[model samples]
Target chain A: MIEIKGLSKKYGSTQALSDVDLQLRPGEIVGLFGPNGAGKTTLIKSIFGYIPYSGSITLDGEPVTRKNITRLSFATCEHSFFPNIDAKAHAQFYKDHFESFDEKRFNVLMEFFSLPKDKAIKHLSTGQQNQFEVIMALCQGADYILMDEPFAGNDIFNREDFYKVLLGMLGPDECVLLSTHLIEEVSGLINRAVLIDKGRIIGDVQLSELEESGRDLMDYIKKSFSYRSDRVFEALDQLVPEEERHEEMA
Target chain B: MKKWLSVLELHAAMRFKRVLLVLGTMIVLQMLSFWILGDQSNTQTFFQVLGKIKYGWIFALGFLAMYWALSWPLGRNETYSYTLQRLSVTERGSVWMKFIFNALCFVPLVIVQAGLILLMAKIFEAGKPFAGNAHGILIDLEKDGMLHALVSFSNPAQVIYRIVYILIATACATHMEVLFARKQTPILSFIPPVILLLINNIWYDEFHVAFAAAIIISVICMITALVRCRGKKPLRDILEQQEV
Candidate 1:
């Protein structure tokens, strides 16, 4: 389990994360949903200790450090693999640095994605690179896998296949804290939805609970965020002339 | 120890090919230098020729090119550093490993210089045996001045000072490149070497003072780099905003 408490981060005068608290447990696929600049990336980076924040983050029982960091893995759209090195070399690197690196899983994912093992990762297409990034995170054998928009450039079909692969590959002890804007697409895949707005968590809901209440994930998110459904129409009303509006109504 | 070796091996593997390429190129350049000297109508002893020839620039350029190449993995566009930081058991170890690797890369250049000098000396002695001198080919240390002072190995103080200065300069420069990659302002990286050179130029008579200053500044730079790296404060403002 990863526990974060009173996490706050500031970029100069602007607050990136404000007293944010969240916990991730085993066997749960949680979707971290937020609009742009809502501190989703900040939260993830803080968890990884990539950036500093004023809070306490503990993995299992101890603080996250080199000794215990192997338990957590991350995949970002920006990519963390050595660009000049091939995927096979990356596997060797992971195997060297991480004791729990799953070489078999790495091979399987490489074959599944049809990524060239010999070619440098930088030479791969954008979508293929994204797949490789996610593959590495999955193969790290980490208990908690944090993916920040790992499917950014991938096609819908590829993402669908990956979601399926992820489902089939994940063990009961593994947890995935996924941050993405594809809410409706991931609705069926994730067990829980964590919503953040303006650097604070607005809602955290279990899919089962939403289903019991006869509500879908999107609708529940809309309610929790107090989303203005008529804002688009209101903006259009201001854009159009009164005569044009009347003509359209007629 | 095993893990440290593994890390070292990984670093070396990533750079071994490029280092060899650079090393091979430098060797060719060294041979070319010798060839050019051999063609000259007015032949001189090894020390005199070495002091006169402008081949030192090749070594300087080689080291500079290598420094740039080594900085590639840590550049903003690359991600090897993220893996490296996470994998390293201690940031200090990473610093030391990089320092050692970079220092070792310069060793071949010195070796090439030594070998070239001996080869040039033998060729000079064998080709022209017209001398009433007892040593056959007279070694005029004073004739070659500064270059001789640097690589002659005749003056123990000068040799020791130069080695210490080069090692420290390498450490500072390598550490500075790392700090720069992490988005930190690293102007201090060039200060030690530049200051040492200026001191050497201005205070040639007070060599001991310049040597002591080199030791002090190198220690300070090493400490600063180690502490800052261990802190790992990559700028938060420049953090990649990947999420929507």
Candidate 2:
């Protein structure tokens, strides 16, 4: 289990994360949903020890040091790959550094994505690069996989297929904490949703609970965020003149 | 140990092309210098040819290539510093491995320069009375200030001083590379090595004091650099928050 407690991060004057607490267990896929600047990326980076934080994060009761860091893998839209290296070379690198690297899964994903294995990552299309990023994170064979908008550049069809591929390839011991804005897209894939706003987690809910209550995932989010359904109409009414609105209605 | 080798291999492979380019250009320029400055006269000395070669420019180009290679992990597209920092290796070990790998990158430069010197020595052997031999050629070339610390292998004390000097220079450059990776411009980091080199040149006769000072300064610079590599609270963190 990966546990985070009282996590807080301050970027100079801005609080990127504040008193955030979360836990991730094996065999579960959780979606971390947040608005822009809501601290989703900051939270993930903090867990990976990419940045220093004020709170404690541990894996299996030990601090996330180099000894057990291989248990975690990350994929980001900003890309953490060597641009000069090709896909095959990346597989070789992962194999060298990560003892649990799954080369078979890497090859399978390369073929599935139709990514050119020989081309350097920088030469690949943006969508292909995104795919390769996620592929590396998955094939690292880590127990906890953290992805931040890994499919940002990928098309909808590609993302849908990838989500299915992810579900099929994950073993019972694997856990995924995926942060993306496409909440509805991953609604079917993730079992739990972790929602954050203003640098604080506002809601954590299980999909099974929402299903039992006959609540749509979107409706649940709307209620959690106090979605103003008529605010759009009110803003439009204010923008348009009364005479113009009446003429359009007529 | 195997992981360190993998890291070294990755760095070497990534840098192979650019190193080749710089070395190729350097050799061609040296050859061109020999051709332009060569005289068939029996009086030709290795110094005559080396004197005409733009040694300063070559050194700058070679060292600049090394600096560029050392900065690879901090590239803009993806900061592999994060990758390396999270590795199972100790922070100090990783920094040392990277520093050693960069030092190795300079081997080709030395080989090329040494080869040129040997070739010149062979070509100008007929003028031995004037050119003196390969050892004499090195002794002759050591007259220059910067090369003074590096080439006096004949003297045991000089050998030790040279090692310390080289370590200081390499460590300073590595420190600068790390700072640059963090997007911090450290113009001051280049000062210590330059001052040491000047001490070597200006106080060549008073070897004991200069050597002691060099050893102390090199050790200090190395410790400072290793401590900065810890990445938790780098000395430069005051400049700005480290994004890595």
Candidate 3:
């Protein structure tokens, strides 16, 4: 389990996150939801130690450091790779540097995706590259996988297929913390939803609770983000001919 | 140890083609000059050629250290954060790995320059219109009262000082690359190396001061890079407020 307490991050004068507190338990898939500039990426990057923050964070009751970093895997919309090198070369690098690297799993995923081992990663199309990124994160032998916008560029078919593959591979002791705008698509997969707006979490609810109350998760989430139901109707009404409506009324 | 070697091997693979392209161009240009200037008109006299080559080497090494060597160490901007996260390497460790790999890559540049000198020596021994062999040219230059231009090459201690100076220059460049990756403005990112190099130039006549200055400057650059990489942020709270 990972625990976060009194976490805050500032980007210059802008407070990106403010006194954020959270916990992540194993064997659970948690969906992180937020709109643009909502501190979602900042939070992910903060946890991964990519940015500076004021916080106390621990994993399994020990402070996270370079030595224990391998226990967590991460992928983001901006694909991270050695563009000049091939998958096979990267696999070798990962194996050498990460004792937890599962080379066999890496090879299997590469084969499954038809991502050629010898071709430079830069040569792959954007969607395929995103797939490869997710593949690398999964095969890193991390118990916790944190992905931010990992499915942005992928087509629905590929995304669905990968979701199935990911579900099959996740062990009972593993956990995945995912952030995506495609909340409805992952509505079934995620056990809980955590919503953030203006650097503060507005909603944290279990899928079971929503299901028990017969609430549509998407509608509930849209409410938290302040989505108005009348906007579409009002815009369509503006398109009608005012003179024609007046004549009909007369 | 194995991880470091693996990174080295991977870096070599990534850069093999570009290195070949550059080195091959150098060799071909050298060989072409030798072939085209076969006992010909108004070309550089052998001593002049030798003088120019020595000067050329200094400029080439300096240029490579300043520019070509740091791009990889900076780690490409687009993929940097993601790569670090997935690979699970601390920023400091990643920078050091690339720095070492780049320093190692510099070995071939020296070897190729050495090879050019050997080829020139063999041609001179074979009675090409060369005035003297490689080392002999420096000896001849000193004999001809041309001491100022070649004084650093004239003594072993000065040669060692020159090597140390170049190391500091390159080390500063590598750290600058890290700062640049941090997205510092152009002038701020460039100040440290420029100041250090300026100090080296000012103290050039006083060898010990210059050497000590370079060492101190390089140490400062290294420390800044280390501190920047050792950010207070830890990896456990990765997504407290992140929107997917």
Candidate 4:
């Protein structure tokens, strides 16, 4: 479980995240949805304590810090493994470094995936590298896992396989916080969704509640943004009469 | 501690190519010096050869130092997304592991080079067919004092001093490299070590002070590097008022 309060991050002239609050419960799989530059990654990083931000982040009620990061595992789309080493060596290194690493589980995952153990990580395809990182992350046996666009480079089969393995590996006590733009693919996988735009949380709704609203995940997302955008247009229209607005448009 | 050590070992193994390249370059330079100076028995030639070899060692040290410094920071791009993902699972020991990994890489290389030199001297002395002052080449082995100096690891005091000195130096070098890489001004990373070397040269007669000063500077640099990395701020934060 994770709690973020009044989280704000600024990048010089641009605000990446502003006054955002979020909470993730154990055994919950939440998908973070946002367009490019929507501060989705910023929010995730801030929660992970990767960057210095004006916010309070607590993991399972404990304040997040460098000392306690071993309790969390993060996987991103990029090749996070040491590119020069083989998969087995990389896994062994992680097993040695992380207190909670589950070597048997990792071996099982690797075996199931049929990931080449001897090939250098650099030689692996982008999708394979992503899989390897995911496998390593899961092996940490941490209670919380954060994934950023884990499906980015994967083929359809690999992506589906990843999701299956990921879900299969999750115990009842584990929670997953995933951020990705592939809303449809992840819609069925996540129990909750957080939509962010322009450094603010635009919507936070349970997937079931969102579904009960009688709209598909994509439709609901589009409608939410459209409704917000329409309010801005309506406010602008109110500043001037419809005739004036029509004349200006003409 | 064992876990951290294992990680360090894996890191060194992953960086095998870079380490091999540095050691290979040093050996080549050593061989080239032997070739150019050509088997002369004159005292001047011996001194000249020794001088070049010493300088060669210094040059190799500099190269290795630079390589060690840049290895982690510049080896990969520091994207916010990537940093966030990595931080999720990373431990503080991960940072310390980098320093230990770099140190472990040089251990075997340095030992093998030193051992081979001593072994070759013994072999030549046993087969005294060519009598052209082979004793001069083997002088370091004959004089226990020089041998002790040459094998710095064998002297407890020297070992402690070198360990502390190299640890600090490497740590600082690594820090400067990260700082420089973040700013995309890697060129400036060389300044700290260069300045330290200059100070060492100026106070060469006071070897104790020079060594201490180098170690102190390296420790300071390492501390600064750790401080800078304490957050997820883009390494470029040091170079400019840029945001990520």
In model 3, what is the error at residue A17, expressed in angstroms? 1.9
Q: For candidate 2, lDDT tens digit of each residue in A1-250? A: 9999999988788888899999999998999987888889888888887777889999999989878898999898877787777788788888889999999999999999899988878888899989998998899889999999999988999999999999998999899999999999999899999999878999999999999999978988888888998998788889997789889999
* DockQ, computed on Cα atoms, for candidate 1: 0.37
TM-score of chain B of each: 0.74, 0.70, 0.63, 0.68
Candidate 3 off by > 4 Å: A235-250, B7-16, B33-45, B51-62, B72-76, B81-90, B124-155, B185-216, B231-244
Which candidate model has the greater lDDT, 1 or 3? Answer: 1
Candidate numbers sorted by TM-score from highest down? 1, 2, 3, 4
On residues B5-107, what C-alpha lDDT tens digit does candidate 2 reach at each position? 8777766666567667778877777677666655535345566555566554565555566555555343465555555655676667766876787667665
Cα interface RMSD of each candidate? 3.2, 4.1, 5.5, 4.9
lDDT of 4 by residue, B1-244 (tens): 5755675575567666777776676666555555464243442323334444453344446445546633544235333224222443343345567666666654554454556445444443444334324656555433333234345565698567545644655665566545554544444335545544543333333456655666666667666666656554443363124333
Fill in the DockQ of model 2.
0.30
Winner by TM-score: 1
Error of 2 at A99 (Å): 2.0
- CA lDDT, every prediction? 0.75, 0.75, 0.68, 0.65
Clashing pairs in 3: A40-B242, A40-B243, A43-B238, A44-B238, A47-B237, A47-B238, A179-B244
Off by over 4 Å in 4: A66-68, A97-100, A227-250, B36-45, B48-74, B78-97, B104-131, B138-168, B177-189, B192-216, B229-244
TM-score of each: 0.86, 0.85, 0.81, 0.76
lDDT of residue B135 for candidate 3: 63
Sort by DockQ, best first.
1, 3, 2, 4
Docking band of candidate 2: acceptable
Q: Assess the local accuracy of residue A112 in candidate 4 as a C-alpha lDDT between 0 and 100.
A: 87
Clash number by candidate, in order: 0, 0, 7, 1
Tens digits of per-residue lDDT for model 3, B46-132: 555554444343425343543444543323444544555444455566667756765654545545655664566466545634555
Residue-wise lDDT of candidate 1 within A1-250, one digit each (tens)?
9999999988777888999889999999999998888999889888878888898999987888888888888899878887767888889878878889999999999998899999978788999999999999999989999999999999999999999999999999999999999999999899999999989999999999999989999998888889997997788879997689889899
lDDT of 1 at A111: 97
Please give the C-alpha DockQ score of model 4: 0.26
